[model samples]
Target: MNSKKLALIQTAMKLFYRKGIHAVGINEVLKVSGIAKKTLYHHFSSKDDLILACLHYREQLFIDWFKQQLDAVPAGKAAILAIFDALDSWFNNRSPAMGEFNGCFFINASAEYGREDSLIYAACQQHKSHVRAIIKPHVDAFEADENKSNQLTDSLCLLKEGAITTAKVQAKLSAARDIKPLAASLINHPLRQANI
Candidate 1:
């Protein structure tokens, strides 16, 4: 993509994420991005196409950041905690400075698109499975038992999904703080140890 198109996509994502997808329009994005109409259409066929590109870009950026955090922490339970650690940074800085401190981009878009065929929906689905895979290795590293990792990955994903929704609806931005105890409980559980 050209620098202008890339800039437009990046700016649009930030705007859409901070403001709901429905609330944002092409004119607003164009005005904010300061990109010309011909340029925008030359790169993106339509608003839907642009939205898809934005979603894909956001997904890639998030995954890259997530992987970097995981690498910074130790493997297994320690690495799993890193996910929460990264979330904590968001919890700490919930304000206009960083834009909307709402919740997961996937969750927001999913609610908006309702599992439809839109690119946002497809990107959301792809992004979620990618997230699960990222945590799979850490879960698998728990003990001698191979399956425990898969189980742990599921449990962690559930916890994450709930956390995102709960934090958004309840206005408890620091909700990730709750995950530590839950994660610890899972890590130190008797059934998990017994399986090994």
Candidate 2:
């Protein structure tokens, strides 16, 4: 996209993440981005449109960063366990691209847009599904059975979501680390030994 549009989305994302989407108005995004109202209108038809774009942008940023983190480690169980280490970095504000930890952006968005059929809610769900997909391959490597792998993937996603939520709500920076052993146990369960 053009520099102007990218600026609008990034600025809006930062603001929307720091504050709620409804709490940050279009004017603030315009002012922070140093772009004109007409320009924002040219890129996005409405605030909701911009919000959607921001969500997509955030998802891409997160997915890319998360993949990089996973790639740095060996695949299979190591890569799976690296997820929490990555979350720990994120919770500690080590991810510059993601900004400070205020909680999962998708979770916050889902809370705001609670209606199941809404595009915003759908976007949030899509983000979650994408995250689960990313973790599936690693789970598959360690769990041969299709059903077991699917269940393991879902369980890992739950642990991830719980870490994010706990880190945000309880202000426990070690939430990811704290939950890592449980995840390790789940990965190393007796039923999964056949694949390993």
Candidate 3:
């Protein structure tokens, strides 16, 4: 995609994610994206196609950002903590248009589409798998034993799911605060201090 088309996707994604995919129409997307209808249609066969493209673009950006954050953390305990650090960065950002930014784009878009057959869904699945892979090592480092590692990894996933839901409902990070203590006690203390 050219810079202009990529810009349209980026702009449309922010609008779609903020408002909703169903609520935001093609004209609004064109208005916000500052792109001509002819150009937009030339790039995307339909609104659905544009939505899929936006999702793919967003997914790539998210994966790149995640990898960068993961690489910055120290292995083992520090890496585990970096998960929360990344969440904090995501939640703490303040914008005039989108305030707290609590909603998960994948979850929201999936809910709006009401089905799982689009490129967007595929991108979301890939993101989830990538996140699981990132968390696996942290789980292993925290527990040492394979069974224990798997158990903790599952537990951490629960925490993540809860955090996302809670943020969505409450529109703030109170639930994330709740998860922190449990995560600290469950995954941090013993694991980081092990081998004593």
Winning candidate number (TM-score): 2
Q: Kindly list the per-residue Cα lDDT of model 2 for residues 98-143, writing each as its tens digit.
A: 6899999999999999999999999999999999999999998868
- After superposition, the stretches of candidate 2 with alpha carbons farther than 4 Å from their true spots are 190-196
**TM-score winner between candidates 1 and 2:** 2
Q: CA lDDT, every prediction? A: 0.79, 0.92, 0.73
Candidate 1 lDDT, 64-136, residue by residue in tens? 8778878998888888887777776665663223334568888888888886776678789989999999998
Q: What ranking of all candidate models by TM-score puts the best one first?
A: 2, 1, 3
Ranking, lDDT, top scorer first: 2, 1, 3
Note each model's CA RMSD in angstroms: 2.9, 2.5, 4.2
TM-score, model 3 to reference: 0.83
Clashing pairs in 2: none
| TM-score head-to-head 1 vs 3, winner | 1
TM-score of each prediction: 0.89, 0.96, 0.83
Model 3's C-alpha root-mean-square deviation from the true structure amounts to: 4.2
**Model 1: lowest-lDDT 10 consecutive positions:** 91-100
